[model samples]
Target: MTLWRLEWLRLVRTRRLVAILGAYLFFGLTGPLTARYLDRILGGIGTEGVRVQLPAPTPADGIAQFTGNASQIGLLVVVLVAASALAFDARREMAVFLRTRVRGAAAVILPAYLVSAAAAVSALTLGTLAAWYETAVLLGGLPVARLLVGLACGALFLAFAVAVTALAAAITRGVAATAGAALAALLALAVADGLTGVPWLPTRLAGAMETLVRGEPATGLPAGAALTAALTAGALAAAVAVSDRREL
Candidate 1:
């Protein structure tokens, strides 16, 4: 608890948290709203007098836009921000003194995990609320079950992001290298999903959000959840193993 508090305080004091949260909030609030007004925006573009007739946007359209924006751009931002947190600390040797004095991997691992989890929870909660409100206002009434399922999917997606970022940070001692590796890993998974047609991978979990929102049984949800759990375990084990071999 004490170590977690210390790490939490460090995270709170960093500008990265504020900046990332602010940007995410903006996107979360605007994603569905923008989707609702897509026709208007496109028509206003007035490209070469080409009149494009767009159909009226539906609830599913709004959800699709929200999921697209959140899963792609939003998740990328999350990975970068989370990777920077620990990567920066490692690069600056910020944990050296603590590592030497604490004499246990738990002191470092627990706090880092707690901080990452807290950030994920906050972002997921805010994004879910914004998505729900936007859907309600723009698309009229939405089912509570669908909303809950979407939220669950979002939470799981955030967990996958945290796990990936932590593993990247643990593997690389430099901030830039860690961030690059994490982003590359994420991008690779996305590319693989596109190429291989596997929706059950950890990286493609966010793509299942729409299914949940439609009250459909999400086929990829359980498989993605299992993948995330396995990845998280692997990341933690790798971190502990690496920490044990390090000189601190």
Candidate 2:
């Protein structure tokens, strides 16, 4: 517990973490608000006597916007922020020092994992609250179940992100390489989602909010969640193995 508290404080003192939270908050507040007024914003564009008619927005529309932005831009920001959390410490030999002092693999790994999880949770919770408030105001009151669904999805996605970032840090020695690797993984998933109809793809997991709000079971969501959990566990194991092999 003492070790975990120290790690948490170290992470909190970093400027990058604060920037990540700010960026996510901005996107979260804007997602639903932008969706609600999207039609009006598009309609305002008038040129050469051309007009486009859009149907009135619904609660689902707002949620869709929130999901889309959160999944796209929000995920990118998180990846960048978390990449350094894992890689930077390792690159600077901080991980090695901590491991030497702590004198156990679990002591070092557990604290790092706790810090990452705490940061991810804090950012996601704030973003969720921002989305909920914006959505409720734009499209009346939202259901509690739908909110829970979103929260769950966010947590699952963040777990996947943390795992991948840790893996990148373990595999690479430089922060730049780690960041690039993490971003590339995210891009590949996005590309696969755009090109293939695979149900369990990571990119599609973000959009699962639709099924939750509609009170319908999403066939792919559960599978995606399971796969994500497996992958996360694998990454954590690999990171631990690598840390164990390194000498301070």
Candidate 3:
């Protein structure tokens, strides 16, 4: 069987595909609902002597909530699922089997990495479409062109995330360790971007949806998106090189 087909079969058989899609779908459906009802929801809490005033819910707020959920828990799920696929060689028997059949590390690893990335991007796109529909119903219609651009930016960031998982898997000995290392690296990048407020940081793509929804000029997004794509390619290359040298 082709490696690509094998990866897809593995993802489905293991149910990671379902988990990733389900998590994003849950957030997509709830994000708009939460944004629309947030004021009433807060009022029900009944904090004594605390008056909380919130702006009326907007389409931007709905999309923001969706991206916010995606950037947090959704991102982690993607990383874990990607790590599981990339780290399949963690078992000695599996490693030997793959090493013997594949021409090189790239042959063994690229399909798994690309399949994981494709699954993640597809899930995110599905969730984004769900959020867009609910936002149009609950709030108002958003700019389709801007939202599409933002979605592209978000997809690039997710692809980069999977690449990071691939690199971590190449270096780490187990699935958990690979996931942890990739998450740690991502967290550090997020913190750095938060502190520096750099326009070119790939982390900026995480907020692309909210920003574009608010009608912000996507002037900075191109830089961030380019950097994200570059980083993803570099990470994939590094993963292949590192895996090539490692002892099976």
* Candidate 1: stretches off by over 4 Å: 215-217
Best by lDDT: 3
Q: Which of 1 and 2 is ahead in TM-score?
A: 1
RMSD of each: 2.2, 2.5, 1.1
For 1-248, candidate 1 gives per-residue lDDT tens digits of 47777667766787656655665577667877887888778888879788767787766666677777777677776776677665644654566756666767656775676587667667766876777788778876567776666667677767766667777777787767777887888788888978987768876567666776666677777787888778877876776667666653
User: Per lDDT, what order, best first?
Assistant: 3, 2, 1
- Model 3, residue 171: distance off in Å is 1.1
For all candidates in order, the CA lDDT equals 0.70, 0.72, 0.92
Extract clashing residue pairs from model 3.
none
Structure candidate 1, residue pairs in collision: none
* 17-113: candidate 3 lDDT, tens digit per residue: 9999998898889999999999888887968877667999989999999999999999999999999899967999988988899879999889998
- Residue-wise C-alpha lDDT for candidate 2, range 1-248, written one tens digit per residue: 47777666767787666866776677678878887878667768766467766777766666667677777777777777677666645554666566557665656666666577667767767877787788888876667786677578667877787777777777777777887887788778778888887878765666777557756667787788888788879888988788677654
Off by over 4 Å in 3: 48-51
TM-score on alpha carbons, each prediction: 0.89, 0.87, 0.97
Q: Roughly what TM-score does model 1 have, to 2 decimal places?
A: 0.89
lDDT of 2 at 2: 77
**Candidate 1's error at 139, in angstroms?**
1.7
